[model samples]
Target: MRMRASQVLALQSHFESTFTHRLKVFLAERLPEARGALAGEEGLARLEARISVARSLGFRGERDACKYVTLSFLLGEDFHEAHWAAAALVDPRHRTPTDRAEALWNAAKQRELDEFTTESVRASD
Candidate 1:
């Protein structure tokens, strides 16, 4: 069946709204610490904006964009620009957006592990 342009637009809008809500719920569940920040109307707006920024940064897939938002919460919004390893994390050599996001995520985890190990050593000293 051929749908009119207005009908197609409405369907697209509805899908976007549903997808955004689902992403919010998933993020809230995965990031308990961010529950407060991800609550209420303002939170939805922030999430939408972050998703937009993620897309702008080459996170093409919804899941990849979600990962980007997760990274923002975990590593700070400007991590790509301000992190000590920012150059490597955002390097254009990655084959795809998924690869770049995965690399960034792994690097963030390694950074946390390194910090934790360093702190432990200092505490034992």
Candidate 2:
């Protein structure tokens, strides 16, 4: 039997809600600092907004989307517009959202490595 448009939309909404909740719980479990940072309605709304932004940026895969949100939480939600990694993410040569996401991830990883190396050097001084 064919489903009505309303039914299809309802089903899609339910799926999205479920996925969002699952993502939130997964992030909370993996990032303990988020336990207090992301509590109740306001936090949920903020997370949902960040996920929406991630999807718009072409992070359709669950893992990539999660990474986007994680970075947003770490760097601030507006990081896309201002962060150094934003250069990699918006580079025209990337040619695809997945490519942009990968570039962003690499930039973030490199930044982490650079910070660690700097801290190590400082410690040894």
Candidate 3:
């Protein structure tokens, strides 16, 4: 089912807020040497690249933003690869934030998901 416009905004807002908090904490916990990387010229270039790739994904939620930045900053992956992996985690329909959420929601509602989840519930008994 297609989500309402308001629902998309609400979900994206939650995603953005959560990402901001987690990104702050993640940055804080890193060592001085690591933090310094983000402060320098090379780090700035890398961060900008990540942001660009994230924009291409067309999902403005926190996860997409964080995934791009996190992979580049922490894992040291290149922009294209990190974005591709992150894109796979979300939806590939590159247009609006609502489209991404609706694609994910529809995927979650699939028969395979229902069957897979039911097995976990049965195992708990």
- Top TM-score prediction, candidate number: 1
Q: Ranking under lDDT, best-scoring first? A: 2, 1, 3
Tell me the whole-model lDDT of each prediction, alpha carbons only.
0.82, 0.83, 0.56
Tell me which of candidates 1 and 2 scores higher on TM-score.
1
- Which pairs clash in the backbone of model 1? none
User: Per-residue lDDT tens digits of candidate 2, residues 9-60?
Assistant: 9988887768778878987988888877678988788889999999998888
Question: Given candidate 2, what's the lDDT at residue 62?
Answer: 73
Residue 5 error, candidate 2, Å: 12
Candidate 1: list runs displaced more than 4 Å. Answer: 1-15
Model with the higher lDDT, candidate 2 or 3:
2
TM-scores for all candidates? 0.82, 0.78, 0.38
Best by lDDT: 2
Please give the RMSD to the true structure for each candidate, in Å.
3.2, 3.3, 11.6
Determine the backbone clash count of candidate 1: 0
Clashing pairs in 2: none
Task: For residue 4, give model 2's deviation from the true position in Å.
Answer: 13
Error (Å) of candidate 1 at residue 15 is: 4.4
